[model samples]
Target chain A: MPYPEELVSPMRAELTRLGVKELRTAAEVDGFANGQKGTALLVINSVCGCAAGGARPGVAMALEHGTKPDAVVTVFAGQDLDAVAKARALFAEYPPSSPSLALFKDGKVVHFVPRHQIEGRAPAMIANDLKAAFDKHCAKAS
Target chain B: MGTFHHDTHELHGITCVVETRGPRTWVGRVHEVGPAGVLLHDADVFDEVPGGPTKAEFLARTAAVGPWPRHKSVVVPAAEVTSVRRLGDLSA
Candidate 1:
């Protein structure tokens, strides 16, 4: 069962507050995952400890980097089941993992961070890892 | 006992301890096992760091208490998995 909306609202806000678009439906996921432009970051948001402790905070810090993806988006796991499933299908080569981040370029996955990478790492370390990926795969933020 | 592939369906629904090639270990009920990898539900993942509890010590502790329940679902890729054991068999 999904957690109550009230319970996860703040969790949702963490990214949305940073201008990350929240794709709450499968159709929305399709719209973003397909026909993407230069670069995009797709975050499989979760209510797990690693997500709270690392993923969200890490992404927030990474975006502060000068070079970053053209767009950033998220689909909450469990709460937005179909949306998360649709997004996961985009990264079929990888196992399904929440709090995962996929960097897409021209509609292809260029880089990915699975749950294992975020599980024990500090937010700053996660941010640095993401910053490196952004530097390699993304353009300088305008 | 009927003979079957130990790495396949035999582990489904069983709570198992999964160790990966990296720092991550997972304790969860097996959901699926295929060429892709093992899928676990209600998984508790422990990522061992330098100077932290060794995998054995962590497993023993988990066996004594319980899995940490960190992830709702997770998949350990076939290439990354090192071993899988029944958590129940561990001597806490």
Candidate 2:
């Protein structure tokens, strides 16, 4: 069963408010994953307690940095079933992990923060990790 | 301007084609091309024509044929991107 939409609505908006796009369908996930040109941040949003604690807040803080992903998007794991599945398929190369963060550049995997990384970490630490990747890969394209 | 640079920050909210190294070729309005990855809206993925055997000549062939879309608005990464090109202008 999926988490109630009412329960997750505010969580969804949390990321969207920071400009993260919510991918609500399988097609949406496929469209984003298939041929992306530059960097993208794909978050597998979940309803776990840790998600609220670390992933969500961490991502929001990470995006505040001067250098960040060109686009931010998310697919709720339990609620957006097909969308979440499709998103996972894109990560077929990597192990499946929800409440995860995958950053891509030019359609290739660059930085990944899996569930394990978030399960027992601080939002600030997570934010720092994402910021580090931004500094390295988000350089202006020549 | 002749000195125009495709600054990473400048790519926010515009449509373009992102050609990369692997099997994915993305097309959509660029949401952002930040240090981590590019975010896009109404994005679609076409097969990335590969190096020797499995590559499909997509844009070249598609341009000759007609406007066809493979996928739409989703998010991925940019670690393998090789090039970015302007396909059209975003509506103002």
TM-score for each candidate, following the candidate numbering? 0.65, 0.59
lDDT of 1 at A75: 97
Clashes of each: 0, 32
| Tens-digit lDDT track of model 2 for A44-126 | 88776557888899998998888888888999988889998888787666545557898889888788776645654688988
For model 2, how does the per-residue alpha-carbon lDDT over B16-71 read when each residue is reduced to its tens digit?
A: 67777777777665667766667766555676344543324554433222123344
Which residue pairs overlap in candidate 1's backbone?
Answer: none
Leading candidate by TM-score:
1
- Whole-model Cα lDDT of every candidate shown, in order: 0.82, 0.70
True contacts kept of each: 0.00, 0.00
Q: Which parts of model 1 have CA positions greater than 4 angstroms off?
A: B1-92
Score candidate 2 by DockQ: 0.01
